[model samples]
Target: MSAPERIPPRSVTSAELLAEGELTVRGRIRDASNAALFCTVAHAGQEASCVYKPVAGERPLWDFPDGTLAGREVAAYEVSEATGWGLVPPTVLRDGPYGEGMCQLWIEATQDAELLALVDEEEPGPGWKAIGFAEVGQGRTALLVHADDERLRRMAVLDAVINNADRKGGHLLPAPDGRLYGIDHGVTFNAENKLRTLLWGWAGEPLPPEAVGVLKGLRDALGEGGSLALRLAALITPAEVAATRARVEALLASGRHPEPNGEWPAIPWPPV
Candidate 1:
């Protein structure tokens, strides 16, 4: 069989294509912790590669309730869309071969896009921001750094709002079109503070003007009876929705990027 064709990101119908398309499982993504199927969705002659993670395949986590990861993935997409940055790819909850699951557009990362690096220098140089130090193999340690691009900064803000528990470097996808996308958001939207991530370079820094404006807009959209509030209510618990609203409010009040609360690990295990 031939390989699936790549979907063009410029398609205005991508969202519709994903929501209503016929999905065919091509293979399994072995590296993924859950049963992530690599599939192709087709609707009205339009076809796109996508990842489908059925709720039945989800592993039970002690902190998060079982069978809710798929919904949380879709919820993260909704919040990402509300941010106006489109940091997360187009995603939807739908039925597939394995039953109900979260299906998302597959983003192919550009081979040359370098978002994270381990440097022997104690501090990061220009065009880079330090994430802290990582212990390399063979009793060596190096500074872990990420690009100082605005795309990542926006993503950092989104991660905070969603209370994402996992923001590993492997989740950051830099597209060929110069757009950055983050994936694997199953462990998110908890009512508690579990915002572990590698994008903490701007921790405690003043929020950019653009970010502040976005936060204000989000605060309104997450209010009672707001469209976002209603949408999130179905995906997560009522307390989680309230917590989402509170996070936006807190960000607006502080007018700065959030710092690690120290109650939880500041970064995810196996950062990459």
Candidate 2:
């Protein structure tokens, strides 16, 4: 067989390409829990790689209503955009081969990026922050640590706002352009507190000044009749939208990274 078609260089308006292009499924991303098709979208002679997850393929979750994951993913992207973080890649909700689904720009992660590490030391030393300990086969344990990078810190705050229940290490993509992108946001924006993540190194620490400014902007954007609030209301339930606004307010009031509330699992199963 001939080699699969490679995507051409993407333009600055990649989101437009994803929303209006012709999407062709190239292959299946077998590792995803849900059906994640690796595809290419072409529009106006511009082609780029993307992932399409049909709403029909989403698994039912007891906590979240079925078939809403796609919209939640889009909602997360909207929130990310409002924060001006660009933490999530360009994403859109569009009809695909199977049905309506979430389409997101596919980001290539660098192989040499060392974001998470398993160290033998008790403390995380200088540039790392501890994320509790983990078992390493033969009844031994090691500390799980992630980089003390600003990108991840922004992601943590984003996760809290979105109530991302599964911020696994694999979801983080360190792009070649030195920017970090987080994917797999299907299980986010629940009405309840379900913020599970591995980037809890800054838990309980004061929010950075930059983050505070962004939060202030978010607060305004998520208020009643605000653009974000209206966008999210259409995607998620009114209750979930209110919950999201409340979470932002709580974060601003506390001015610190959120700690595990102890009501649910702090870290996702099979972390990483």
Candidate 3:
């Protein structure tokens, strides 16, 4: 078995970071979604890379309107703590020309023994592929079959709180270190919207006993009585916040395990 993975914490302050990296105003990675550049820094005479996403200019994509990426990142860091899944590590958000920008946690590579076997360069799909294991005949049919269920459930609750409407298959990555990390949290905390890609494959089903306990822990940690509730209400609408709290309460009260909902589609976009 692989040892548990850990996301290294951040200690560098904003001023220290600004002083370290050269201002290489990059725009090559720019597409419709976002515009980004890397902060190139030297450590012991070695160059290290980290990405910085600047706010979009006028006539920007509505997906990240008003430069909410920085706020969303801050919120994600906080909610990730509430989930206890440890999927999101520390990240940095800084000021930019038009709006707030962000310094994100960079992923070095994808490392999964099972996924490597399924790789086929000929038809490596649209997203990142696992090429190293294609020669070896080893892969699993389903994603995260061996994942810690309790941890997944905790993550689900965190998604609920954040209103993460886009938990797509690609967003979940299995690291070489045997840990799961969730990325792309720009579409969260709208209050009225909670569209999802995964987790609700089985909706309206009772959560497992162990999952229930974890939710209980999450709720207790997030807040009790009306204190935490008020805080969330301020960020999200009253009705939406209440509904979320109720869902948590319902999970804690029920004993049945989760089941397939068989109603909603995987992605909100129309099938191509």
RMSD of 1: 6.0
lDDT of each: 0.93, 0.93, 0.51
Off by over 4 Å in 1: 1-12
lDDT at 234 for candidate 1? 83
lDDT of 2 by residue, 194-257 (tens): 9999999999999999999999998999898999999888788888888999999999999999
lDDT for residue 251 in candidate 3, whole number 0-100: 56
Better of 2 and 3 by TM-score: 2
lDDT of 3 by residue, 1-272 (tens): 99889867556643345434443444444542566565554333344455566655323436434336545655566556555567764455555444456555555546443321233244334433221221232553322222224444555556655667677555665666766666667666654444564554234556666566667765675454654555454344455445556555655666443333344343434110
lDDT of 3 at 80: 67
TM-score of 3: 0.59
Model 1 lDDT, full chain set = 0.93
- Considering only N, C-alpha and C atoms within 3 Å, which residue pairs clash in candidate 1? none
Worst 10 residues of 1 by lDDT: 7-16
